[model samples]
Target: MTDKNPDKGFVALLGWSLNAIEAVDRFDRRYVVVAPPWAEDYCRQNDIPFVPWDFDRLNERSHELALTLEDMGVDVAIPIFEETVEWAGAVNAVLLKNPRLLGQAMLFRDKSLMKRRAQLGGIRVGVFEEAHDRGDVIRFLKRVNQTLLKLDGDPNDPIHFKAFDKSGTAGHRVIRTPEDVDNIPDEEFPALLESHLDGWEFAVEAWIKNGKIEFLNISEYVTLGYSVFVPATPELEAHRERITEEIEKLIEVFDIDFGFIHPEYFLTSDNKLYFGEVAYRPPGFNALELIERAYGFNGYQGLVLAFDPKTTQEELDAFFPKEVVDAKGHAGCFGVYPRRRVVSRLQVPEETANHPYFEFHELSDPREQKVAKRSAFGTHWGLAYFFGDNAHDLRDLLKRQEELDYYV
Candidate 1:
C-alpha cells in the first residue's frame, strides 16, 4: 500500500470512517486522520496516522489545528462527514492560503444560503423559505397550497421541512396538514421550508479538479432515504449530458475549483432539472461503497485526487473508469427498518436470501422490544446490499426488501 511516488499530496481527512481510512491506507497518497479524541485508541491500535481534535464550532482557537496540520506538511483537508465540512474548508483555507474558501464552505452548510446562491446562479429550485418557528412553517405551508389553487375539499400538497445544517434526511419532515406542524418541536425551528417538487429524485456524485468535472455518476433513488443504486438505469442515464451541464453550472455557482460534491436534483415530468441542495462531502446510505461495488475503484481515493493540488491530469484520467460503460454490473443497497410494531430478532427473508443477486446484509438483532416512534425519515437499523447484471432486477430486488421484515 506504500506509494513509490513521493510527490503525491499529503491529505488530512477531517472525520473518522473505517471504510475511508482503509481505502486511503491502500492508496498512494500520504494521509492522516483528524478526528475526535474517541478515535485515538482505535487509530493507535490500528497503526493509523492520527490527530485528535473535536470539531466543535470554529472559533479564534480554530487556527491552532490549522497550524498543527500545516506544520505536518498536509497539503489538503477532506471532510468525510457533514459536521466537518466547515472545518475542512477552514483548515484548507489556511493550508492553501485562500481565505475565501471558508465563506464558500458556509454556503454548503446552510440550506437557505445554498438555495439562494443557486437561485442567484440561475439554477431552478422549488419555492423555499426559512422558518423561525412553528408559525412560520404553517404560514409557508398555507401560502404554497394557496398558490397551487386547491379547493376547500381538495387534499393539500405537502411542504418539506429540513434542518438548515444537517445532512440527508436528518431533521427532515413532510408537513401535509396543519396538524402535522404541531408535531414539530420548538427546538426544530429555524429550519428551511420548501414546496415539494414532484418528480424523479436522484443524486449526483461529481469529482472536480481545476474547475472541471473529473468524474460524475448519477445515483437513482428507488425510495428516498431507503434505497439507492449507482450507474443509474438507461432511462435516467439518458439525462447524463444535461446532468453534467448542471453540475458544471454548480461548480461555477459555488466557485469550486476542486473537491467532491454530492448534490440532489429532481427531474420533473417536463424534463427540466431543479436543484435540491448539495453536500460538500461523501454521501450517506453507503453511497460511496455502492459506487465502489458498481465500478472498480475506490471513491475515497478519487476524492483524494480531486482535493490534492498536486494531482496531475494523467493521474485523474487514469483513476476513473468510463462511467456506466465500464461498470461491471449494477450495485444497490436497501436500508432496513423493522416493519413490525414489536420485533424480537433479525431475519433475512428467505426469498431475499435465496435471490441470485443477493450479496450480504449488515442487519443485527433488535436491542429493544418496542420500536421507537419514527420521526421524519427515521434512521435505518442496517443495510442490505445487492449486485447483479440487470439494473431492473437490482431495482426490483431493492424495492421488494421494504415489504419483508428484517426484524421479527
Candidate 2:
C-alpha cells in the first residue's frame, strides 16, 4: 500500500470496486473499503483496508455506521454504487454535520422525486408519473399518447417504465403497445413512467467541488445500452456551451457540493435540452476506464479529489486536462450480447477485429446451450474496446457491430 499523507482527509469508500480501491490504494488519502461480509476474505488476502458492513436498505442500525467512522477519525464518506448513495448520504449527514445532505441523497436515488424536483427547478423534462401496477402503466401509455394528439388507428407513442432506484437501463423498458405492458414482470412495479422525448439522448459526467462544476465530459451514445464513446461527436460537442449551462443549472438545483455525478440529457432536433435523471455514483459500462484511456488521468483519483473537502483549486486545475483539446483520440466500446437465442460459442467477427481502431475484447464462451430472451435492454456478455481519431468513424463502427452476430 502507498503511504497516506497524514495531513489530508481519511475516506471511507461505501462499496467494492477494485478499480476504485486500487486508485485510492495508490493515492495520498487514508481509506477503508466498507462492503458486505462476502468481501472480507478477499480484502484480507489482498491487504486492502476494509470494514465489512452489510449495506442493505437503511435500518435502525444505519446510524451506528456514522458513529463508527467518526470514532475511526474518518473525515468523509464516498459512495461507489447506486445502492450506496443513500448510505453515503446518511453517513455524511452525520460526518459533515449537515442533516440536509441525507435528504439531498434521496433526490438522487429516487427517480420520480428527482424528476419532480428538476421540474420545480425549471429544468425541462418529459411528462412523467409513478406507476403502481400494470393497470397504471396501461393508463399512462394511453394518456401520454392522448396528450400527443394521437388519432384513431395511429400507433401509440412509446412511454418508458423504470424502477425508482435502479441504475442505468436495468429496469428500463419501452412500452409502445398494451401488449408490451403485459410482458412486464410483477415485481418491477411501483416504477417511474416517462413520455418518450424524441431526439438525441446522451449522458454528461461532471465533477463538482464547492458547488461548481470543475470538469465536464459529454458521452455520446450510439445506442442507449449497446455502445458509448467519450468526448462526443462534433454534432453533440456543438452543444457544449449550452450543455455546460444546463449542468450549472443542475448543480444549483441539486445543491450538490462535491463528488461526481453522471446525469443524462436529451437534445431535441430543434436544439432544446431536457434533463434525464442523474446518478450519484460512477456509470456502468466502464466509462471511467474509457475516460482514462482517452484523457490519460485516473478518474477514481479525481473522484477522491472531488470528495475530499480539503482539495485545492490548484490541484483541481492540474488534475483535469482540457476536455476535448487534450484527448489523444476517441475511445469507444461495444457491449456484446448474443443475438441468437441458442448459442454455444464466442466468435469475433473478422470485420470488427481487422479494423485499425479495434483494440481488445473480454468476450467468453457460452456457459449454457440456451440464451435467455432479453428482457429490456439486457446486460452485455462482455465489452469490446476500440480507439481511433475520428468520432464519426467510431460512431459508425459501433453502430455496425449491432448487425453482426458475435455468438453462434
Candidate 3:
C-alpha cells in the first residue's frame, strides 16, 4: 500500500473500476475499495486495499458496510457506478452522520422522483409519467401525441420509455405507436415514460465543492447514442454561464452539498433550457478519459478530489483547468456496433485509421457472427477515440464514423 497523509481524508470507493483504482492509487489520499467478493483475487494480486461487499439491494445489512468502514476510520465513500450510487448514499449518511444523503442518492437513481423534485424546485423539465404496464405505456403515448393535436393521418410524436433505475440508455426506447409499445417486455414495465423534447440535448459534468461549483464541462452528443465530444462547440459553450446557474439550482433542489453531478439538459431553439435527468456517478462514453485528453487532468482523480471532504479549496483551484480555454484540443469517441447483422471480422477502414485525428481504438475480431438487434443505444463492440484542435471538426468526425463500416 502507498503511504498516505494522515491529514487527508481516507476514502472508500463503492465499486470496482480499474480506472478509478488507478487514479486513487496514484493520488495522495489513502483509499480502500468496497466491491463484490469476486474482486478479492485481483485486489490481492495488485496489493489494493479492499473490502468484499456485494451491492445487492439496500437492506438491513446495508449498515454493515458503514459500520465496517467506520471502524476502519474511513472519512467518506465515493460511488463509481450506477449500482453503487445508492450504496454510497446509504453508507455516507452513516459515515457523514447525515441521514438525508440516502434520500438524495435515491433521487439520483429514480428518474420519475428526480424530475418531480426538479419541478418542485421550479426547474423546467419535459412532460413525464411513470408506466406500470403495456396499457399504461400505450395510454401515455396516445395522450402525449393527442396533446399535440395531431390529425388522424399525421404520424404520432415519439415518446421515450426507460427503466427508472437503469443507467443511461440501458433500457431506453423510443415509442411512436401502439405497436412499438408491444415489443416491450412485461418485465420492463414500471418504467418512466417521457414526452420527447424538441431541442439540442447535451450533458454537463460539474464537480461541486461546499455547495458551490468548482469546474463544469459540457459534453456535446453528436448523435444521441453513437458519439459524443467534449468542450462542446462554441454555440453550446456560449451557454456556460447559464449552465452553471442551473447546476447551482440543482445543488439546492437535490440538497447536494458536495461531490459531482452529471446532469443532462435540453436547449430548445427558442433558447429555453429543460432538465432531462441527473446522475451522481461518472458518465458513460469514457467522458473522464476525454476530459483527461483534452484538459490534461485525470478525471477519476478529480472524482476522488470531489468526494474527499478533507480536500482544500487551494487544491481544487489548482487541480482543474479553465473551461474551454485550457483544453489542449477537443476530444471525442464513437461507439462502434456492427452495421451488418452477421459479421465475421473487424476492420478499421483506411480513411478512419489514417485520419490525423485518429488516436486509437478499442476493438477486437468479431466475437460472434450474429449481432443482436440493437435495443435502446444498443451494445457497442467498442469505441474509436480521436483528438483534434477544432470542436466542429471533432463533432463532425465523430458523427461521420457512424456510417462507415467497422465489421464485415
Tell me the tens digit of each residue's lDDT in model 3 across 65-101.
Answer: 8999999999999999998999999899999999999
Candidate 3 backbone overlaps, count: 0
TM-score of model 2 vs. true structure: 0.98
State residue 190's C-alpha deviation in candidate 3, in Å. 0.3
TM-score each candidate: 0.98, 0.98, 0.98
Clashing pairs in 1: none
* Per-candidate alpha-carbon RMSD to the true structure: 1.0, 1.0, 1.0
lDDT of each: 0.93, 0.92, 0.91
Per-residue CA lDDT of model 1 for 64-103, tens digit only, reads 9899999999999999999999888888889999999999
Off by over 4 Å in 1: none
Q: lDDT by residue for model 2 over 1-408, one digit each (tens)?
A: 888898888999999899999989999899989999999999999998888899875555669999999999888899999989999998999998999989999999999999999999999999999999999999998888888899989998899999999999999999999899999999998999999989999999999899988889999999999999997999899889999999999889999889999999999988899999999999998999899999999898889899988789999999999999999999999999999999989989999989999999989999997999999988999999999999999999999999999999
